[model samples]
Target: MRLSDVWPVRGVELRHGVLELRPMTEPDLPTILDRLPDDLEMDPTLPRYAALDPGVGRAVALVQGYWRAMGGWSPQDWALPFVVRLAGEVVGAQVLEGPHDYGAERVVDSSSWLVQQRRGQGLGTLMRAAVLELAFGHLGAVAAISSAYLENAASLGVSRRLGYADTHTSVLEHNGRQLQHLRLERDAWHGSGRGRAVTVRGVGPALPWFGLDGERA
Candidate 1:
């Protein structure tokens, strides 16, 4: 996949009947504020203060800054976030992050979350798959990665469905406890080759539309 196309970074949307991700708007703020996930608070893996760490702290802060800059969050760089929708209702946000224009060839890392109401319905797997489509299909991302709390079976479960193999584990603190972390790489994803086929159209206006060989469209 080509990885240089600069997306709108404003109001991008990924759609599939019943399952979709749209940009955040003022009206959506209520839903966003109302439905944000508190996984870190409930997970045993997170440290009592993992959220304070520079990496995790920066990650969350950057999301806030980006949201404020756009006056709301949609999909954009470093933290390309989205409002995951199901049957026209807001459910969560899917994020693509890590270094953009990473290294020479370009790579991306994905992260995502859905409100408590949407969990256990298999929506998490679909949402991450949707993020992959954005990264590999339109963004021309040469490769990708994903990470999750190791003990968070549900999150890891989604990775498994999307073909992410276990990389290694690290320990960190979140809300107020220690949590194990797991990493996933693109090579393992390809080797597994098990995620559902996700396709997108009608995104021309949101993207710079790079050509097949990765030159300008």
Candidate 2:
């Protein structure tokens, strides 16, 4: 059997006009690594997860982590990772993660980043909207949760545009300093009005992996 037959999510894809988002397979890894930025120039308040770090070390860690995520997936808890492409070129990544019992909790969280040169052009918002469509429209998620550093205006702006509301705040220690966190949630996402048409493909084959196919007639 093919890999998608064993792990159905590998077959999923989302497209909006010239932009497309699909699972990052082994062949796509080198391109993603080559595009890694040497200097992210992110705000000091932002949390720096190891995978998002710049430099060779970060690249190695990312490759390892990506493979681990693919190998470790289960119905109990799984991460749906997608590589964002524009006109068939790899630009970045968008991800949605949730537990197997999501049907009960009805919640999922997301994280994403685009290449530095591609920033500020609203591709981030478009990428997110594609996944939000998959979550709320296809996966039956009742609420979507996200967090960003208080000083990260770009991220916060995307969340706001997508109809996410401030939920709470917390503090985390990042690189020996306290970083402010802004938690946001959207119980109602009525589309971002950004004029990008989105389409999801291969979800029907993956529905059983997410435990939703049984409910279908």
* All candidates: TM-score: 0.67, 0.83
How many clashing pairs in candidate 2?
Answer: 0
lDDT of 1 by residue, 8-122 (tens): 4444667654687765554665566556555533223223345485445434543454455354322333445577877777788776653544434456776666778778998
> Which residue pairs collide in model 2, if any?
none
lDDT of each: 0.58, 0.73
lDDT accuracy of residue 108 in candidate 2: 79
Tell me the deviation in Å of residue 10 in model 1: 3.7
* Model 2, global lDDT: 0.73
Compute the lDDT of residue 113 as modeled in candidate 2.
Answer: 81
Q: What is the lDDT of residue 183 in candidate 2?
A: 33
lDDT of 2 by residue, 1-217 (tens): 8876877788888987668999988898899888876643333432346654357665765676577667777655667879999988788888887754665676778878888888988998889889888877677676778887677788889988877778777776544432333333444464444323779888888877766764431
Top TM-score prediction, candidate number: 2
> Compared to the true structure, candidate 2 yields what TM-score?
0.83
Q: Which stretches of candidate 1 lie over 4 Å from their true place?
A: 1-7, 40-65, 68-77, 98-105, 173-196, 205-217
